[model samples]
Target chain A: AQSVAQPEDQVNVAEGNPLTVKCTYSVSGNPYLFWYVQYPNRGLQFLLKYITGDNLVKGSYGFEAEFNKSQTSFHLKKPSALVSDSALYFCAVGAFGNEKLTFGTGTRLTIIP
Target chain B: NAGVTQTPKFRILKIGQSMTLQCTQDMNHNYMYWYRQDPGMGLKLIYYSVGAGITDKGEVPNGYNVSRSTTEDFPLRLELAAPSQTSVYFCASSYSLGGSGNTIYFGEGSWLTVV
Candidate 1:
């Protein structure tokens, strides 16, 4: 079964500092990974995804992710963290050709002012 | 496009009472999914439809039912509401991934509480 694991239950970072949310995955074949952010009482918003080629994938709100095939990891990163960037983050993995997505437990990111 | 839209932003139901959560999308997406988000937990798939008239069970389908009567409408029904059923429900849609997979668009969500 395809699954994703987010090691951190929560990540705390100061405003303007770089932020990283670690995600690892296990799948039978090449994985299609995605990161989603959920604000309080709202639905998840897509942050970024790793499909193929280009190890570095850029996404919304200055967020980016690096697909490390050697490590089977796709970690979300931002050059500078904003207080507004604090939210619940989820990592999901789907098979290269399958539509079914398996998601991680989620990590709460807190950006301190 | 309006993407996916969910009705009844919030609802509180008594035990045994049943209600349906309505979802619609204008994206002409071929795939639609229903998911429930619980506190501190990742979203759980309740049911999904590949297209109009084709529906299937997902990870958590018990105590819930879904129908896709039109290509644009997919409504989820909760039978005999229970406190355990209280959670925020989300509707999402995506194009047929074919072999590459596609990004899904989600609605704001519908909050339901069974007391």
Candidate 2:
């Protein structure tokens, strides 16, 4: 059984400051991690994914995530936050040969101006 | 490019009333999925299909049914609408399973409110 956990329900950061949303996973085999963002009344948009690659993965909207195998974590990061960056972030995990993805509870990010 | 399109962007249903949420993808992807999102809870896969005529239940399939009669369309049917069923429904598609090219594309979502 594969699962994902987002330890924070909400994260607040000041605009222009670096923002980090934490995510961790548990899987029996090598994991395929992903990050998605959802805006108000919209579906989730893919941010980035880490299947087998460098430890750091960059994604859309100036966002990036670090895939730390030892820590079993894939935390999303942005060098500078914007007020419009406020949205819901989700972390998902899937393994090879699995067609489905298991997602975390989701973390709401709010960028204060 | 209307990647993934879902009908009935917003809907209101009474208890025991049934409805079908329509989904279609122009990407010609082989895998399609249906998910429900609730407050604070991430997307939960309700059903998925590898191709036409093949469908499988996901983590949460209770009170919901789905069919994949065509490669481009995957419709989710709600048999008996309940207050618990009041949530936003999303339709997604992927080119492959888990890999570098297997990024899933999602629809704008269908907001269903069961009274």
Candidate 3:
């Protein structure tokens, strides 16, 4: 079975400051990790994914996430935050041959301007 | 481009009533899924289909049913409406290449309220 955990339910970051949203996962084999953002009354939009090759992967909207194998963690990061960055963030994990992807409870990110 | 589309953007149902949420994908994905989202609960898989004629239950599939008649269409059915079933439903589809190359695409979502 594969699962993902996001410890923080909410995160607040000041505008123009760096931000991070933590995520961790458990899987039998190598994992495919992903980050998604959802705005009010909208569907989730894919941010980035870490499949293999690189421990650090950059994604859309200047967002990036680091995959730590030993720690079993993948944390989303941004160099600087903006007011428009406020939204609900979700972390998901899936292994090769697994059709279903397990998602975390979600973290609500609020950028204070 | 209309990657994934879902019908009945919003719906209201009374107890005992039933409804079907329609989903279609233009990408011709072989895998389709239905998920329900509740406040603070993230997304719970209701049902999924690997391809036409093949369906399986997911984490939360008790009150719902699904069918995949074609590669592009997968519809979810609610047997009996209940307050517990009220939620925002999402339809998604994906095709795998290998080495975890699958990236699922989601529909706009349908909001259902059981009164």
Candidate 4:
């Protein structure tokens, strides 16, 4: 079974500063990793995904993540944080030949102004 | 394209009541999923269907059941409501390219309260 781990329950960062949300995964084979953001009373919105390619993957809203194979980590990062970016984030991992995606508990990001 | 549509945006059920959450997709995708999100918790999959008449249990399927009678509709049934079942439910669908890299689209979400 594929599983994902989000180490932080909540992260606080000042607006205009850099921010990071950590994520790690355990899978049998090559992993297909994804990040999603959810706002209040809304469904999740896909941010980015890492299939197989370059270690660094850029996503929506000036966000990006680095797929570190050795570390089994895919941490979401943004150079500058915005108040509007404060929301709940999730990390998910899936393996080849499986339609199931295992998700992490989640992390709440708060951008302090 | 309307993408994925789920009905009953909000519902309240008494204990022992039964209800079904309807979901439909207009994208012609072959895969659909049902998930529930609790307060401050990650979404937990209840059931998934890869195609018509094919469904499988997911991480949290004990209190829920699902059926896929057609390619576009997958309705989730809760036979008996419990207070613990109160949460926001989301319906999602995706197209599998015979691989693991397809993107999944989600609906706005249906809020349910079991009292």
i-RMSD of all predictions:
2.4, 2.1, 2.5, 2.4
Cα lDDT tens digits, model 2, B67-91, are 9989999999999899999999999
Docking quality class, candidate 1: medium
- Candidate 1 yields a Cα-based lDDT of 0.90
Q: Model 3: per-residue lDDT, tens digit, B11-98?
A: 9999999999999999978889999999989999999888999999999999899999899999999988999999999999888521
TM-score of chain A of each: 0.97, 0.99, 0.99, 0.99
Q: Please list the residue runs of candidate 3 whose C-alpha ends up more than 4 Å from where it truly belongs after superposition.
A: B97-101
lDDT of 4 by residue, B25-113 (tens): 99999999999988656888899999999998888999899999999999999998999999999999999831286788889899999
Candidate order (TM-score)? 2, 3, 1, 4
Query: In model 4 chain A, where is the ten-residue run with the lowest total lDDT?
Result: A94-103
- Could you arrange the candidates by lDDT from highest to lowest? 2, 3, 4, 1
Candidate 4 per-residue lDDT over residues A1-113, each given as its tens digit: 77889999999999999999999999999999999999988888899999988999999999999999999999999999999999999998888888887778899999999
- lDDT per residue (tens digit) for residues A5-113 in model 1: 9999999999999999999999998888899999988888888888889999999999999999999999999999999999999988888767578789899999999
Residue-level lDDT tens digits of model 2 in A1-112: 8899999999999999999999999988899999989999999899999988799999999999999999999999999999999999999999988888888999999999
lDDT of 2 at A44: 88
What global local distance difference test value does model 3 have? 0.92
TM-score of model 4's chain A, to 2 decimals? 0.99
Looking only at chain B, model 2 earns a TM-score of: 0.96
